[model samples]
Target: MGHLFSKRKSRVTEHDKALLQLKTTRDKIHQYQKRSEATVEKDRQLAKKLIRDGKKERALLLLRKKKFIEEQLKKTDGTLDNIEKMIQDIEFSQIEMQVVDSLKIGNESLKQINAMLSIEDVEHILDETQEAVEKQREIDALLSGGLLTEEDETAAEEELDAIIADAIQKRLPEAPTDVENPEVVLPDVPETLPEAEKKAQKEKVAMAAS
Candidate 1:
């Protein structure tokens, strides 16, 4: 029975048949529109010939026929547009169905995940881990005899300070009191330059002047 049901589900249904019918109708509409366009052109040429032959009334009648065919062409085009859009909308709706099903599955998975994990549960685990770490540290300190005495720590800090001061004093250079401050002179504003530098300076001044 299940196999038979699966077979029936695989078979083409009313919707598939309807879509095929719509496609056939759309093709027929296209053929009719093309024929009508040709008829409009033919009537236009006939009207032009009639006008040339001085039969203005006949020419106007032929033009009227052409206009009627043009109207039919417009109707056929509108019908074709509607049918094509309907087919496209139907096809897109199938995709939307699949997307909805997929979203349902994703939401179910998230629900399952949420069922397994809660905020309070996570916080409890984190608190336990923190307590475990602090306890481990306390145990280690107990085994290793804990920290230095206050007097021993003070003496160690003083020794470190002395070592850093001695290092700084050895690395420092003597102050030079005779060093002059450099003058801020523009390249082109130098009154005189050395012989080799003068040529380059003069060229810079010339370029600046230009």
Candidate 2:
């Protein structure tokens, strides 16, 4: 993996170096083109001056030279344009390569991380957790086992039932018109609503709001 990664990195670096070289060459071409253009313009002006002074032959010679330089300038322009295009292409390819390399590195890292957590390791941990929960339950059962006798538990249940019965009897509204036993009291019942009722009430409120 390390070797492969290093090879890819080296390739990217080489591509960058090649792009730099291309840009340098392009800049040199541009400089040469500027000088060539200046020479061509100067020659054209000199030819015009010679023609005004009645030196047609000399003027023609200078014109010929200017024409040659103009040709070279045209060729240079073409080369410079090509170099510019090449530079842009190289830059785009370099960016693509960098992105590919980054994704590769990320994928390799994820693979390594996944390797560290093998299926066996995960299963082992789950098994240990289950064992721990079972052991805890056994310990709890052992600790609370003798705290309450069967008879004692039964008596406690009976007492609870009697208390519940008495509470229900007290809560019974004898007769709504029993004036002698008039009471102003809240009901002795659980205040918590059932899940279904709560859901229905929420829906009703939402509908009303809408």
Q: Whose lDDT is greatest here? A: 2
Runs of candidate 1 with Cα error greater than 4 angstroms are 1-24, 50-64, 88-92, 114-152, 155-210
lDDT of 2 by residue, 1-210 (tens): 465456432344777788889999988988998898898889989998999999999999999998998898889888988889999998899789779878988898789879989999999999999999999988897688755789987996566545545544566566444367667554545533466754565555457658
Candidate 2 TM-score to native: 0.51
Candidate 2 global lDDT: 0.78
Go through the candidates in order and give each one's C-alpha lDDT: 0.74, 0.78
> Could you tell me which 10 consecutive residues in candidate 1 have the lowest summed lDDT?
1-10
- Tens digits of per-residue lDDT for model 1, 1-210: 123224223567566787788999999888888888888888889999999999999999999888888888888888988999988887777788769866966677777779999999999999999999999998997677576677976886566545544544555565444346545432443233356654554455457658
Residue 58 shift from truth in candidate 1, angstroms: 7.1
In terms of lDDT, the poorest run of 10 residues in model 2 is: 3-12
**What residue runs in model 2 are displaced by over 4 Å at the alpha carbon?**
1-13, 118-210
The lDDT of model 1 is: 0.74
RMSD of each: 22.8, 15.2
